[model samples]
Target: MILERHGLGWAGLAIGLIAPFFIATPYALNLMTTAAIFVMLAVGLNIVVGYCGLLDLGYAAFFAVGAYTSGILSTELGLPLIATVPAVLVVTVLAGLVIGGPTLRLRSDYLAIVTLGFGEIIRIVATNLDITGGPSGIFGIPGLFGDALSGPVALYYMVVVTAAIAVVLAARLGRSRLGRAWRFIREDEDAAEASGVRTYRVKMAAYVAGAVWGGLAGVLFAAQLSAISPAGFTFLHSALVLMAVVLGGMGSTPGVVLGAVVISLLPEALRGLADGRYFVFGILLIVMMLIRPQGLWPYRSREHGTSTPQEAREPERARMEGTL
Candidate 1:
């Protein structure tokens, strides 16, 4: 049964990989490209928030760092988007360490607040710094592979490849020993530490991993838009990604990806809503929260678990793994 499911999943992925070949309209292609970027961000956050049980309200900070890094470098230095990948990884890691080092020691509410503050700091610094071009942001950013590979079709594939890489890396990480440590920490931090798990380092690893992927997604964002600004990275943007992780079922990769796609495409889908859409959206969110607080696609029950009365009432274990 497992192999059958895997085969079907991979087959579906193959078809989705070729989806852009059939999508000829620039508008449709652009929408899909944006969705891919959203998926990348959600997946990256999954590492920290979903798997590790950390509450990061400022994940957009890493995302902004990545996009700005590539945007500034490519536009000001005559560098290619591909050339900015390493820097994005490095800068984001440093940013994660600088931020995570100070706050990972705190429990939930504190961590969340600190991360939220970190996010605002990144944006405020960008707004005040000339290197980030202030409010105008860095425009005319270059794409990967230059103009020869700058067509919509090329970009679609480029983003698809990058998102695919992130998904694979995240999945692989989740299956490793470190991943298990993260899970342990999430389930019970004190117990994890008692069991000889270095909770601090494990949490830091999750944070850094998330930062790296988030940063890479930023590079793709810069290449796709070829322009960026403070407006692009906002509190609402961070909240939306968090909503995707939650609504899609925190910790499940497939669920989170689906959440990312829906969250990204929702505004376009609601174009007919016009001025009333946001109002309706709030209503729907309230309804959904009441009806399915676990999210749109929730984690599956474990196959071999004992259903102790208390355990039965407990929340389901995350089948996939992502940050909420």
Candidate 2:
């Protein structure tokens, strides 16, 4: 378990270090950067969907909030993107708390509906509000690290660094005590509460954390686009982000990253596949689902102090276990 958990981090670091050398094409570099950003989104959502087993249908609302907050502040107020980080955090957390607090008491479809409505509310507000520039959206939002480091390549590096940090923080949190609480809630909320876990609070925490994560990804998105609008934060966007988490193998960091990369880049890569490519792609997705319903790399369970699966009692083996 230790090796399984740490191995992905080591591999990610190694890949990030070495990828720049092989990927010189600007298009390819952009794809990688976008993948990293989506990976951040997936990791954050994993906290809710993977660990906590919450069906968050509106994750992208937080992302839009972060993006819009940074875009508006940076353009209208003449602040740098860096200055907008705190606002992004505050808005996302409050949004999460407000949305999650009430709906979390409800289960399944009911909770999903409230979250979905919250998503639409965010998008519509951005569309109708003058401060959000209405449908025209904000433009010329500043880039990261100021003008001195605003080159496309330089911004790519910035993304690589920050995205890495986000990924690390999320994975660490997932392995912590709270993560266990989330899992317990996911599996059986009442049982977890009976066992002294505060199901309501933990669920709220998970929702807030996931919201913060989606919001951070939005900040990065704003930095990348240097613009914001209601058009950009749509229901499809939320579905895509959620799809990445699901297809990637919930609760598995590496699998989520792989899933994000594949989902984000597949369209670009499929440019050569012609008009019917989507047909093939859809077929492929179906095959993947049929084969790996749990995920491409499912989180495994084990007995203590052993690397193998716990099996049914084998009387003969137990008797010979006197070798202990």
Candidate 3:
């Protein structure tokens, strides 16, 4: 089964590599590229919400921080966008720690509320800060790849490679020991704690990891658009990312990718529906929730132990009777 899954992943990567050859227009390429970036965001959020089971509504704050970090470094310091990646990574991780350290202690709705407030706070601060260009945000940002490979087609390929790596990394992380810890916490925090897992630390790690991914996506966003505003990192952006993870299948990498692609492309595909497009979209989402709540590609757990409660209990009972 694992081998089959690996083969499927490689095949998907192969198709993505050749996708541009079939696309005819720059607009189409742009849309595809955007979808790829969005996929990264969804994958990142999946670490926190899907794998770790922490609800984060302020994910876009990390995205904005990355974009702004790269934007500032590139425009003001005369650094290349590629050169700013290290700083972006550092800043994002710190941002995650700053927010997650205090807020992860809260459970359920309270955590969500705090995250939501943090997201708005980041946007508002960006809007008022001069370094972020106030309300206008940053512009004249350099490309990730220089003149050697700066065309739309080239950038589209670049984004495709980055997104593929991000997804693969998320999937790999989900299978690691740390990933198992995240699953434990997600399933039951109290049980996870009793099992010797440092629940707070594990949750923080997931949040930081998600922040890194979101920030990297932001770097791509800045490079793609060469400009960003507070408007780009709003609550709606965070909600959409959450929706992608939920709609796809939380903790399922391929499902999250499919969900992100659908969410990104569906609106464009439904543009011809005129004024009824959104209505149709809503209905489709509702239908999907009703019929396939687990998601289009739900995660399939590999571990299957045969020990049943009765079977295990029989041995204990026999041992007790013998002792008596």
Candidate 4:
């Protein structure tokens, strides 16, 4: 399974590298770049929603925080775009703590509601603040590679590389010790706690990880657009990202990436349908859910010969009774 996954990863990287050579149109590059950023966002949210089972409706707040932070520093402080990354990381971590600290305690619908409210609060705050340009948003931001490598092709390659790295890192996290703790909480929080897992801290770590991912994606977004407005980071944005994660198999990294690409590019592919495209898209989503509610690529355990707790304990009990 690991070898197959690595093979697929290599194939994907080859395709991304060669795509520009085949379809080098500016519009196509821009669209592909946007889709890559969306992949990052969906993968990030997967850490919180898919891995830790935390439904975060305010995930876009971290995206906004990252974009605005990078935009403000670059435009106001006259810092280069790359220089703002450290600051973006710092602000996003703080934003995660501020929002996740209080809300991670709640479960299910309550947690979702609070997160939705927090997402709105962040948007409203950005809209009203003069520093954020009072809904006009920041403009004339610097390029990702500055004046040295400033074309659409350069930007596209840079974004693809960054997104690929993000996906790999997220996948690695999913296989780490921390990732196991998250899955434990997701499977059964009470059981995890009983087993000595620090549920709150584990959830917090997931939230922070997701926040950092979203924030980095935002920086990429800001670099791509060269400007941003409050209107860009709406609840709709968060919903679309969540949809990608759901449509792609929540805990399956490859599935999430494929889902994100499909969600991001499908509408564009349906442009010929005109205004009815959205209606068609909606119907398609409904059909898809009904057909494969588990997701496009539902997560499956790769570990072979693994036994359930009951099965493992049975051997111990038999041994205790000299029945082994």
lDDT of each: 0.80, 0.77, 0.86, 0.86
Best by lDDT: 3
TM-scores of the candidates in the order shown: 0.90, 0.89, 0.92, 0.93
Per-residue lDDT of model 1, residues 190-289, tens digit only: 7667666778999999999999988888888888989989999988989999988888777667667778888888778787989988787778777876
**Model 4 TM-score on a 0 to 1 scale:** 0.93
Predictions: Cα RMSD each:
4.2, 5.5, 5.5, 4.6
List model 2 lDDT by residue over 1-324, tens digit each.
Answer: 322357776787678767878887887777777887888888888889887888988888998889988888888788878888999999999999888888899899988888888899999989999998998998898886557677767767777788778777777776677866776677667667766777889989999999998888888888887887888888888888888878877776666777777778776777788997877777877888799886776554322332111221232123223321
**What 10-residue stretch in candidate 3 is worst by lDDT?**
305-314
Q: Rank the candidate models, highest TM-score first.
A: 4, 3, 1, 2
Put down candidate 3 lDDT per residue, 1-324, tens digits, no spaces. 121266776787788789889989889899999999999999999999998889999999999999999999999987778899999999999999999999999999999999999999999999999999999999898889545577888888889899998998898898777887787677667766765678899999999999999999999999899899999999999999999999988888888988999999998899999999989988988899789888877776645321222232333233323332
Best by TM-score: 4
Give model 4's clash tally: 0
Cα error, residue 286 of model 4, in Å, equals 1.3
Model 1: worst 10 consecutive residues (lDDT sum): 307-316
Better of 1 and 2 by lDDT: 1
Error of 4 at 267 (Å): 0.5
Question: Candidate 3 clashing pairs?
Answer: none
Ranking by lDDT: 3, 4, 1, 2
**Local accuracy of candidate 4 as per-residue lDDT tens digits, 1-324:** 121266787798789888999994789989999999999999999999988889988888999999999999999977768889999999999999999999999999999999999999999999999999988999999887577677888888888999888998898898677876777777678767766777899999999999999999999999999999999999999999999999988777888888899999999999999999999998998899899887887665555322232222333223323310
